[model samples]
Target: MKIIFNRLYADYLMPSRLGEYEAILRQARDLGYAQLAVRDFYRSRDRSPPGRVLVHRHDIDSDLRTARKLFALESRHGVRATYYFRLCTLDIGFMREIEAAGSEASYHYEEVATFAKQWRIRTPDTLRARFPEIRQQFARNFDSIAERLGCPLATVASHGDFANRKLNVINHELLNDTALRQQCGIECEAYDDALLRHIDIYISDRKHPVYYRPASPFDALGRDRAILFLTHPVQWETNWIDNTRCNARRIIEELAWRTSASC
Candidate 1:
């Protein structure tokens, strides 16, 4: 089973409403989920993740301090979760603290480095001038982040740097760089099938499977072992309008697609 957590929401509430996040922690505890997976990434550098705060780029230090409070809250609730940080924002000391707290840390690879390298908008001359430095910086960022976290970053996930269409295919290039994953000691890539297998293999193919779609929580009553439930804690408690709309659309789209395919 999978439970989705939005790291940004925890960060958002930490500064203004710590209790709200604590409430989420309580809910996760109530749900009997031993691990809570928190997804995190750096903003600025002229790009931001899908729903993170962009203006906070003025100071990375402050942002990290805020993020730590969230980890602390979860710890208070007696739940340990994986913190998936992007390659650009790895802080060794912070990661050490996370590990000390008995939490797991892992990678959030950006797919653009592997598949969308040629999609730069600059002219060949300009591209030649900027490409090497960009790639070098990105690689350094990846390495440093991986190093700070120590302990052979085991799990894998993505930061949505590539297009959504590409994600549907379960691309291994997301974390298959032999030099990197091997050097960093990252274990299994969290492809969809792998996640499904982690929950229950009966509903998922044991080999050559790319993805598995589970019914939404709204429709999961009487469901069996192979369950995957994704709920944004921040959205659920805060009732964030945008999260509500996005999830509504996802449910509607899934239902429509299922109906069409079944016919």
Candidate 2:
């Protein structure tokens, strides 16, 4: 019966609306989870507090408008979260607005894939040969984003490009290099295992549902365990149909932009 209900909720009830998210936040509070912006979690590492912790993270894949809405919703509940924006989607105004609303902002980078596509470097050999150049470009892009934000970005989340089969590089790999971390001044990765050490559970609304293989937040609540919830701003629509339509529109827009750029 519980499994049936979870499936139904995943299919019909989730990729929740703002109101649903608000209710979830309230429930987390009631369950004794303290909300922390990613930066706050790092700062409190030495003086660990009692009770569970919830680190809310948003990957702003597209649509700054919707991201702003999520930030406002979190603000209304007096909860803070981290927002990571892609270089192609950076909006200084929106970043500043969310920052003012008490959310932390950082980069969502896809430098390796971008470099691969730009150079048409498909093979592993080609990618290996151009590794240094790719790293240089990554640093430059990071600097550009940080300069625009007018502050150093402490954390970054890798943006995955599954469509790029030629360059199968994961963006987070850049952080694995100690020199790159020191040079870029990145204090943490959004999905770093080091950070996960403090978290007892992790949940996400990936692919438009509360993905449950191992477990979901619904399963972990009231267990006195720290949780990390990752969500994409594009998923939290009023309903599944609307979310699908919005995503379709974004794909069309992206295709049109690429076509126009090529011409």
Candidate 3:
């Protein structure tokens, strides 16, 4: 089951393993591309670098430990990347560590969508009607992030939840409201038009069956003059041994979820 899971989900889970991620960082560095965290990149828009630039952004969907591992790798390579962590993965100490390492520490919000699930909001009309409450919840969540981390919150990325897809709602909708953004005191959104306008190529290693998507990390390597490399930390491991072990747990958890859902 481990092998089958690994083969079927290649780039989706643990294929962009730590070793591979390290190699990519080295390659990008060798090709004259210095890593820029998302917050830094957005904040320094007017002073954008002329040479090759790589914005390596990670969305912490599942594991904080894996994020720490990725952070260590980037620190060793002298690369400053961006990490947008979900509320579920927030660890104040680790976030402080990331900031100290010269990387950007930010949020990965999915509150609006998660709330929609809890409220049983399935239709667009219902979503709109309850949006005011959901928006308030969004700001409150940001407050928690700031208070818990005891630091300033700047840039954030919205997580795409399964609920959002099923409801035809975009998670970033919370950030879209100017008033809500002001309430949260947010600086930038990862998907903000201003930030994305400068990216020459957008590459993401989201969940997908190995065969459903191409598997080469090099697919965008060194080819684009400016690149936004988005990845999930949970989908990476240090090596095959770690990857297989992690996959085993993932499989069992998945099976259990399916079993319970079917009941």
Most lDDT-accurate candidate: 3
Pick the winner on lDDT between candidates 2 and 3: 3
RMSD of 1: 14.4
Q: Write the per-residue lDDT of candidate 1 for residues 1-263, one digit (tens) a residue.
A: 11133343432332344464465445434544333332222111123322211110011112344456667776777655555555444567777887777665665565443333334322233333443454445456566666555665555555542233332422244344555556545555545343434343122111011112343322222333223232222322233453355456557644543344211
lDDT of 3 by residue, 219-252 (tens): 6667777788888765664344444565675576
Ranking by lDDT: 3, 2, 1
Q: Which of the two, 2 or 3, has more TM-score?
A: 3
**Model 3 superposed RMSD (Cα):** 4.7
Error of 1 at 94 (Å): 1.9
Where does candidate 1 have its weakest 10-residue lDDT segment? 52-61
Give residue 41's lDDT in candidate 2 (0 to 100).
86
How much is the lDDT of residue 173 in candidate 1? Answer: 42
Clashing pairs in 2: none
Task: State in Å the error of residue 154, model 3.
Answer: 1.1
**Candidate rank order under TM-score:** 3, 2, 1
